[model samples]
Target: MTDTLLNHHDEGPTTAPPLLLGPSLGTSTALWDKVAPELSVTHRVIRWDLPGHGGSAADLIGPGATVADLARLVLALADSLGIDRFAYAGVSLGGAVGLQLAVHHPERLESLAVICSSAHFNGSKPWEERAETVRREGLAALADTANARWFTPGFTVPGLVEDHRTADPEAYAACCDALAAFDIRERLSSIGAPTLLIAGREDPATPPAHLREIADAVPGASLTEIAGASHLAPAERPEAVLAALRGHFDGYALRGMEVRRQVLGDEHVDRAQARQTPFTARFQDFISRYAWGEIWTDPTLARRERSVITLTALVAHGHYDELAMHVRAARRVGLTPEEIGAVLLQTAVYCGVPAANSAFAVAQRVLAEEDKTEG
Candidate 1:
């Protein structure tokens, strides 16, 4: 259905990889507040509200809406932002929407994480009854019981409860309708994206068993059960949730490290790892994940081609130290001494004689060291 898009909050660098965060039924983008910022450091995190739940208009969805409807709105949001593919993570109803996208719109997802959600939602009976009650009496009565249903004992998030209490009854009931009709059990095996299932160990609503069922069905899917957490794992146990999301979404980290070693050499990587402190660890991971895993691993350009471009950039920027290291890398990647000199010559033409002159000296020193080693 053609409608105004859902209300959303966009964070992090726009140029970073996109990650869409979806909220549970009664909650808004606020559900992700605790975890989104950390994820935003590596990704463009876009958190969206359910229809009528926050800033979104009630008319964005109507009664008898399906999870498919919510999924469409999410896709519409991504399209508007010019994101063709993204990693997705969601909580409860939001997780169900992620499942829908994984099953039907697999091409749009780089990865999927379903947190405290299930495929069938324990059938349609309970949701239908809940929908009927909300339609007749509104959300106040249900909101009063949300804390027990959502969190472990002696814990609560007041803002989320307030969101539940203030949600439009009609729209909330429509989300229930969507839940009532959603049953992707049969289609679980068809989901092709890399999938992760996070279960709140103490969650009464959708227990660990529910997430396990999904993990068993989805190919290559992994599951993580967070201790002391209930339905809203990201809120109750933000660190645990963040760790799982990073492990799943950054599956590239291992590959990136391998590529880094290949391009930078084992001695360099070993020294860097030995020198890594807490402060520099994240920066190193960014280099491996973004530079080697993504840009270098991409097959569109050969290693030799990348070396040429990298050398040119290093020369133009006059980063002599970096240029020296890459000169060694260029040799490792199969660039000959003559080819390296040719690249430095081109840099002299465009990058200026002085910068290229410095680059040539660095390259010459590196090449002389290599010759001595070979001798």
Candidate 2:
């Protein structure tokens, strides 16, 4: 059974959070080639091939296969890799499988991103017809239309087209059978995982409306539409797709925490974390994701400049405790005691004498503590 699991490519550190990338019906792991490496920097990215699409055995799925069947195969692959729960992002049929996991196997999923997919694929007629066509004449005819169906006009990835051309006709038809039967709209509201929908603005197969429908139904789900892309957005517009997936996976939290540690020092952050209670956890997350992640991590202003501004703001608000913290942060960002004094003196002129007076007292105490430790 381990050998019978879907073929997959794994990247990134084994200790990092697991993220699985699923491919469209006729595509394979190659579909994520452009984006997975970058995502792997912060996540353990594992992209898999559909049965017979890439390296997997053609018999892994059969003619009457359902999206739920595919979801189970995905779980088998994760289990083989020692992963119990994972974030998932998939395109088209792949996305449908992700939805199946979120709805049924919620405990195995951390989050989901459904790209160029729908809860229900229009209806069964078109897919049924396509499946029959492939069973009779093979994938050549459909493969010829891959570029037009998958991307905007004049944009073609030859490798993807080749993947479509080479897919096992029986397996491709079975996948179509899965799509034809897939309709999870009634259960959309029950999905509890954090969900994101990425739609290709130019996709003719599963248009932005399809993604929007999922967004509207799934609680707390968000939608993003990518211009100049079609069904295979990750292949056609990888950078945009990468950005959306990264944001959905909370890449900001990882980047933000690194910045927070640098600005506040490990001792301060660790101490604050030690004191964090369940009641204050959400507020702490906000500070990390918003204050440190988005604003402080912005490169427009250097850390030193931000420290100065933060100090002034704290003085203006008469927040002595926060001011004391920033005064220490100021030194970490390379502000000399003299520079700190200069900024506080300017604050006295503008923020008022009393506010600056209080700020100085706090800064003096922090500096004295640091001197004692250093000496």
Candidate 3:
């Protein structure tokens, strides 16, 4: 898009928190049409057609532009629009961009939700070759291949594939470059914002394995897998994906507000209420009532137990950052070293040896820290 082509498609009330949505590679913002309406119920949803797709200009940063650069551009767009901070969600290329933003410009985000994206697109040669083909012959050349990875056999009807394959070739190729250069495994630890990682069980491209890697890297990140869906989980199973996003973001929003209140005090929250920035104010109402008042306040589980459950789920699913958060929370909940070890050992069988190995190392470090503090 043009330097100033920050198109804003507002759907909800002005009082709602703005959700900046990034689209997957090879597809325009139209890919979010179904999900956006549901999200708009509580959020002022803003979807963008990245450079070279939809009405946005093509290749504004040229062919060599990395996904990080695209992230910077999106942040710039938010800045220009007076959005000091906002929640973000993305799929595929969009998810990669969201990852970069969460790591690099964390202060500019309240929460992040990534779907069908990986921190590292490793262990696959076919994807690389297909990316190369798109970079040369264009997206149409790999239409069949892309369809196979994006949707399940049943969902890959002729009409659906054709619709997905209609993306702009140049934009799709640029996205391929972004994907090829994307790798944020090491930087995931630096992401401070709460995050949700969603994967399609049937996603052949960025499969559950890749999603596990992302969850493992980003501290305290949550993961949810949608059964019987493909790479286009948001589209193929919009309800499941939307519910996950809504629930996770809602919880984050509530918890963050509560924490802010505790740390900053009620006077601060009241002052914030009076002079709240557009970005902060919009999320306060919905997040406080729904996220904190409803979900977080549920009496069925103690926060301590909930923390352990959340962490255990992440560990079992190979979400490292989330596991780390839970590890820290475990200490807070008075879980002994032996108990933490037991959790990791149990997770090893369910999540796999390699993941369990990493979890053990993290648990050991966290426990060592606890010992030092107690000393």
Best-matching candidate per TM-score: 1
Off by over 4 Å in 1: 1-3, 251-255, 345-360
Candidate 1, residues 1-375, lDDT tens digits: the string is: 224988899999998889999998888898988899999988899999999898888888888999999999999999999999999999999999999999999999999999999998999999999999999999999999999999999999999999999999999999999999999999999999999999999999999999999999999999999999999999999999999998888756788999888988999899999999999998988888789978999999999999999999999887999999899999989999999999999999999999988998899999999999999
What residue pairs clash in candidate 2, if any at all?
none
List TM-scores for all candidates, in order: 0.92, 0.73, 0.65
**How many Å off is the CA of 31 in candidate 3?**
1.6
Give lDDT for model 1: 0.93
- In Å, residue 175's CA in model 3 sits off its true spot by 2.0
Ranking by TM-score: 1, 2, 3
What TM-score, to 2 decimals, does candidate 3 have? 0.65
TM-score of 2: 0.73
Which scores better on TM-score, 1 or 3? 1
Q: Give the count of colliding residue pairs in each prediction.
A: 0, 0, 8
Per-residue lDDT of model 2, residues 1-375, tens digit only: 345899899999897789999999899898999999988876789999999898888999999899999999999999999999999999999999999999999999999999999999999999999999999999998999898899898999999999999999999999999999999999999999999999999999998898999999999999999999999999999999998997899766778889999999999999999999999976787688668987899899999999999999999999898988898899999999999999999999999999988888999999999999999
How much does each candidate deviate from the true structure in C-alpha RMSD?
2.3, 12.2, 19.0
